[model samples]
Target chain A: MMIDHPLPPGSTIGILGGGQLGRMTSVAASRLGLKTHIYNDTPDAPAFDVAAAATVGAYDDLDAIARFAEQVDVVTCEFENVPAAALEAAGRSACVFPPVKSFEVAQDRLTEKDFVSGLGIAVAPYAAVATLADLKGAILRVPPPALLKTRRFGYDGKGQASIHTLCEAESAWEIIGEAPAILEGMVAFEREVSVIAVRGQDGTMRFYDVVENVHRGGILDTSTVPANMAPRLAGEAQAIAGRIAEALGHVGVLTVEMFQTGGASPSLAVNEIAPRVHNSGHWTQDACLISQFENHVRAICGWPLGDVARHSDAVMTNLIGDDAGEWRQNAAEAGTALHLYGKAEARPGRKMGHITRISPKS
Target chain B: MMIDHPLPPGSTIGILGGGQLGRMTSVAASRLGLKTHIYNDTPDAPAFDVAAAATVGAYDDLDAIARFAEQVDVVTCEFENVPAAALEAAGRSACVFPPVKSFEVAQDRLTEKDFVSGLGIAVAPYAAVATLADLKGAILRVPPPALLKTRRFGYDGKGQASIHTLCEAESAWEIIGEAPAILEGMVAFEREVSVIAVRGQDGTMRFYDVVENVHRGGILDTSTVPANMAPRLAGEAQAIAGRIAEALGHVGVLTVEMFQTGGASPSLAVNEIAPRVHNSGHWTQDACLISQFENHVRAICGWPLGDVARHSDAVMTNLIGDDAGEWRQNAAEAGTALHLYGKAEARPGRKMGHITRISPKS
Candidate 1:
């Protein structure tokens, strides 16, 4: 199917999720004279604040999804977990980016690892586990002190547990419930980094600078661009990401998380992939000419991608839960760009906002 | 009256008018985690598309004004012509930036000119005209080749006529109708520039670089930062604008347009003042670290003023009417940032959007 060329300014872009990513994307769409309609099951979604219109309906409601898709020129999602039924409906009516194939691969841990490994990208040893016998047998080759993660519907620190010993495998499996899962061998790495790359409708791809990520309590804490890794290694990460994007025939933003393994001559190992605009790319909003959100919208609208040059060195720190209470000081500080999600409550461990401070390159 | 220390995130900001300025202001406010409620009489106002809440009610509706004010932490206007009654009603419930004095001084051409002249600023020669007799008498003093502009409700070269001779005086009076007006002598100037300044609630003030503006048919066509005038003369213009802002005890953004006259250390004559974010300041959005819209939001929120230094040289060209059809080319151009108002129609002479091209400083 051929997608339309260069959507007109007044056209509507439909977004699948109404989280912070959707909110920021909608804001970017508005900047280009494009309106956004957010579809989410959650009431009072943050994206509703900035979107032109919103619908709170279950993702499985094919009727509602068809109505939404029929109303917009293009359809995109802020998260990889969009139900296949909804995507199928939207795809029938409008163009969906990162394609349904990309979603199918990213939504499952084993499939994502298999897909990256198929591209000849190095990934941690992994074996699927549908039962206790599968886990026990997989542990023989995958080794102990491995991560046992649910194959679906998991994010942040949830749906994963460490198997420190053979005795702990059953408890780990019990903790993740009866969901199909994967057992992965852990790797000793110096640091973590991610590449934010976007693929346009015509297959043109652009990558922003690599970002070094720090996690606390299994949640992203900070992302610094021009990641302290060697330039050669950063280039390698970009190549790996580009190859993955091309293989998936992906459109819109694709974030490839990698681990810097070995010392002296470091190499990248694929950690996972997020087929959407990522939290680690938030610094691009303040440090670059065109932000990841804007690039995503441009990619889906079939418009030419913008320049991705970084004019400044930047550090982005996430404000989770109670940390957002310091917004006053953040607003008062010079060089700080504060962004709050406008969530109703500050539940512990929930993302509330982020602050990006940039220093112009001298 | 003492202003509050700071407005926390999640607080509501009520904007008095809904237009492109209001839309951009709401987007900036949302960036800082603040919600915005747009109050305008027009149906489906452009600002309403991005605002959290909107009320389509007349400014003179005291009951609606009171209810809107009660829902917001602070109130600010997107234009200078906010009705005095509306201001009074909102003031009783929430803090209103720029106060009523700034509005009174800027709403009337005669009063605005008188106020600037009283501040010891050089202004074009002017005399008040309330009737045909007054126009005839003022023409003799103000001179033959001059303009007669309505004292109120005048903008974009509307409600004014050129008086070239005694024969044109009666026709000019009839053109302006029964409204009291101002007859002003023309200033022979080489170029026009504007200063965008903001005063915080705590009285701390900041000014962005002066912008040189070009007009076509009395509507702003382009605004370029770092005007081509001598640096010393630019400094003088800034000083004059700073003094006006201080005299008015103004908060939020204040723009003072000036005309540079004569050569060799050209002197500046006060042209007019906009007590809100002005079109000439739009270039700051892409060139400066903190945009005029963000500064206005900070001032009204009682947060400290942000850094206003220009990091890039910028030229902003307005996409009036059908000019917005070139959005695809603008989007494709490198270093150019496109902003559209999300307006549904492209009426002739209407400002639909703007394109700003920025060159990063070496």
Candidate 2:
């Protein structure tokens, strides 16, 4: 999206979704003297505690979206799952950063894969499936040991099913709620990693280090910096992230999840791109000079993006549910960085907080 | 002046100044999921923008301090210049972190020097001046080219006068409003450094690296991390800071500014201690795993202290006066961290914002 220079402070940042991400974005924006308006479907969200303005309404609440978009100078989303209709609503009045292209590429798994591959980017072997017959055919094309993912709105292992063989095909497709889906042959990956890149309206792009992520039951559990991998593989992950960001003329933080096929000839492949700041990029707030949230704010507001520089090699661990009990121990770590999401309940698997350890040198 | 088991979060943080510092303290408190009430004399201060509550009355207003103190869980100050009387009043009602000891130490230069020396800590040579006769006598002991600073409520280079000889004594004293003051010999130092440390209510302490700071006209201009000093001297500096915090029973982040007297075999001498998060520690917001402000909130509010561990080696430059004009440049330096203190004007020497850079290890 095209943006003019210097969207001054005091301008309201129209934030879509009222989760912890929105809460943090609001905090960041407030620190810079900017106002933030949070619009979300849920009313009892944690983000509401600190936000100055909030509209407790659904994404499809056009009237509210119109008023919100009109009131703010720029629009941004906390999560990528924001419906295209909602994004279009915000985009109609204020410039939606990351652009509609970002959402379009990210909303559908097949489309994202096609977009990445079309950019001459490497993706795991995949094929599209609209029917159960198509799923069976896709399995024949790839292998019995493959996965089926719904084209839209899948996160943290939801909306996807693994098929060990054709016997599980129909049930798997049925489990996905019969949405448009993609079948993908898995890569022999040693680790999962993500790159958080920020691009500006002026075509300036910056990439943070490739952070290796570990998932527990499809939920992000930890993200460690330095990727503790070969320099070449790390560089390749960052390069692919940069390429993907530039290809879409992406603005704000673009988080690309990739698999590092750690082998004799170590390599990496793109998994998916999160159009906004993702959970994986949370470490940058404590580990890097420029936090992913600040960069997102800078990019969306038409301000020059700050440096994507790493100060300390770091590790970020998520505190889900009962893990929050360790807040005391984590906070006492002298150098371990702790960030609580301000969530009140430690519901099972709910992200309550995180801790980061930044080691400047070996 | 002893404290045990850290005060917990959801407690209150009492701030003294209602300006940007209080504003920021409130912001940090809110981020850590704590409540903050800024106890300043101004109703229209910048801090009002973010605090849960603000007391707009005189610092010497005992009724106001009592009432304010009665409402909070724990008390902390935003600026060090909070009158001793106000601290006494507040402490009568609430558990004031840092105690009244730090206030006594900060209010009088002579007391500070004597206190540091009494603790077997190093300090610049100095003497007290209760009268013009005392000024002459003090200078005779310390020699020519000394500094005469008012014993109380002096800040922003005010309440200070430089004395070269006995001939300049009366005018120098008068320049400081003829208030009770002290005459100190010059500190012939190679560099100025500060240790920003957090002491929990439980007595647990954490320290950031020794920061080399530069001052322009008595106001901090820049602070560079890994201050390029010997680790031994840094350790000495940290030790001195820890002693000071322990001595005061300080809880929350306090900064001990010191002079590095020599280059080789360098020695550190106490200059002053800010009982709250100091401007020099602002870099912690980006350079460390936990920011001093957040840690300060955690400390005073009974939350556990976070790691004072820095994520990267860094440099922080204050955007004094019109220097904020270069914010765009700073913002554009990929990974350059920017923090604008919501001050509207760009007056000469005013701290409007700051930029920090955290360098990754090669």
Q: Which has the greatest DockQ? A: 1
lDDT (10s digit) by residue, model 2, range B121-152: 98888888888889889988989789998877
What TM-score fits each model?
0.96, 0.88
- Model 2: per-residue Cα lDDT over A1-362, one tens digit each: 46667787657788888787887777777666666778888886656654556788888888888888988888888888778888888778888887888888998899999999999888899999999999999999989678899998898899989999889998999999999999999777889999888888888788888888999998999898878788777788888988998888888889999987747777778998999998988877776666788889988888888767676677889888989878678876766766676566679978877787777644
> Can you write out model 1's per-residue Cα lDDT over B1-362, one digit (the tens) per residue?
44667887788999988899999999998888889999999886888888888988998999999999999889999988888999999999999987788999999998899899998999988999999999899988999789999999888888989988978998898898858999988877899999999998888888888889999998999998889888888889999989999999999999999999987758999989999998899887777767899999999888878888787788999999999988888998988888999898999989999999888763
Q: Count the backbone clashes (under 3 Å) in each candidate.
A: 0, 16
**Candidate 2 local Cα displacement, residue A102, angstroms:** 1.2
By summed lDDT, the worst window of 10 consecutive residues in model 1 chain B runs over B1-10
CA lDDT, every model vs. true structure? 0.90, 0.80
